[model samples]
Target chain A: GESVGLHLPTLSVQEGDNSIINCAYSNSASDYFIWYKQESGKGPQFIIDIRSNMDKRQGQRVTVLLNKTVKHLSLQIAATQPGDSAVYFCAVHNSNSGYALNFGKGTSLLVTP
Target chain B: DVKVTQSSRYLVKRTGEKVFLECVQDMDHENMFWYRQDPGLGLRLIYFSYDVKMKEKGDIPEGYSVSREKKERFSLILESASTNQTSMYLCASSLFSGAGELFFGEGSRLTVL
Candidate 1:
């Protein structure tokens, strides 16, 4: 079974600052990617997503960057808030294989006031 | 609005006891999923249903069974709960039609003593 690891690279940002959380995926054939935000005692919410054909996509206060060449994806949060503190996950899917998402080990983002 | 809701926020059961976890989705999405989250493991798929009465096994399906009699409901069952099965269980849903983003529920933390 593909399992997420406990150890994760963490990033800390002050309130009103910008935050960027990066992840490196293992499978190169993955064509779609999404970023999820999980707060304490809550389920994960969709932050942003980017397809493999594109390099970057932006949403409300969030941006997702996908680099297929490096099998890397990143989430950028603009004007980080204390409420933005969360464990962020990157999930990849291969369109050719029924599109099951393969998740990367998440990164923890701590936004300080 | 909560798109997905789990039946319990926490559960305590003795070893070898049968347990059931219920989930319901209100968005009318065709895809419903059950996943377990551990301290080190982010989220592992236990089972998923694409439609009523249809199901598929995800990355980790051992010791688990699922039932999906209706489009909006999905249930996970542990025939015999073990200490290894104690973890946070989450349910999610998503639409088909080429859009692949999942909306998750606040997890059910189960403890098997």
Candidate 2:
């Protein structure tokens, strides 16, 4: 059974601090990964994505690091702000399962003032 | 701007009732998916379609069915809704067959009493 899981259920950080969310996947053959952010009343939006071939990928204020050896993935948010407070999810592409993505239970990030 | 629109924002229905959730995408994407989001469970794929009139069952599709008569419209049908079926249903579309980024709708929250 292929599964994606998060290390933490919730994370709290100060307004200007950096935030890190961690995820672990079971399938070693999985190659593509994605990070999504969901706000209070909105659908999850894509934040960043990385392939197995790439060790890290950077977006505007976010970075995704993938360690294939450990089947671990992490999202780093620099200078986390109030608007960055949301549930972050890591998804793995399951090629065997009709190419649908398998999403891990998200980590809720709260940026306090 | 890619847009995926869900017809209903929220709905409440009694047990054994039939429910229909509609989703439409404007991107002319070849891939469309339906997933359910729950607390501590993240998102679980229910069904996905890669082409018109073609549908595939995802990880959790036992209580749900999907219809994709048209390329841009995908509908999720609950034959007889149950209390356990209450969840937030999200619809998403992607250009590729689940390998690319997915554009999601606001989501339709259904409560089965």
Candidate 3:
């Protein structure tokens, strides 16, 4: 089945270092993509988003890059901090599916001090 | 600020019991969604409502049903709860059924024994 999936399930990074998470999507028609951060016992929070028309989008400390040719997506977080420890998920919006999002399994990011 | 509120943070139910999870959004969004979060499974959409009284089944909607009688509220129902139905339920709302971020509630953790 065509779905969004993450390459790694867990990632550990040192505080002050940068962290990167990768995702692969199978659908070619998806036009929008979003990244969410989820803390323990809480709902997923919107981190950043990018559209297929643009290759990259930057937020406060995060950046999302999309490669339509290979159907790959990546999230880069700069200066990782202890508070940045959480699960990150990449979601793709299927316009044909009436605004539903296809989410990746998620990558657990742990920033060690 | 947009706020999505779930009725319960945790619930315990016996097998074969009927379960109901309620969600309400204050933003008067036109789209609402219900998803189940499990370890290694990410967010699996159970159902979604685009407008009042309009419902659509998601990928894993076999054991779930939804009700959206009003614009601000959406409900998820488990006809016969089973042990396998134990999971964290998340409710989300969006302004429209297009490319945008979803505002999610805290979540409801259900345990069926």
- Which candidate comes out best when scored by lDDT? 3
DockQ of each: 0.58, 0.77, 0.82
**Candidate 2 off by > 4 Å:** none
Better by TM-score, candidate 2 or 1: 2
Q: What CA root-mean-square deviation does each model show from the true structure?
A: 2.2, 0.9, 0.9
**Weakest 10 consecutive residues of candidate 3 chain A by summed lDDT:** A93-102
Candidate 2, residues B1-113: lDDT per residue as tens digits?
99999999999999999999999999899999999999988999999999999998888999899999999999999999999999999999999775578888999999999
Worst 10 residues of 1 chain A by lDDT: A1-10
When candidate 3 is compared with the true two-chain complex, its DockQ is: 0.82
* TM-score: the better of candidates 1 and 3: 3
Model 2 whole-model lDDT (C-alpha atoms): 0.93
For model 1, residues B3-106, the per-residue Cα lDDT tens digits are: 79999999999999999999999988899888898865677878888889988988789999999999999999999999999999999988862248988999
In candidate 1, clashing pairs total 0
Q: Return the clash pairs for model 1, or none.
A: none
| lDDT score of residue A96 within candidate 1 | 43
Residue A15 Cα positional deviation in candidate 2, in Å, after optimal superposition? 0.6
CA-lDDT, candidates in order? 0.83, 0.93, 0.94
- lDDT tens string, model 3, A1-113? 35899999999999999999999998899889999999999999999999999999999999999999999999999999999999999999876766688889999999999
> Residue B93 CA error for candidate 3 (Å)?
0.5
Which segments of candidate 1 are over 4 A away from where they belong? A1-8, A96-99, B97-99
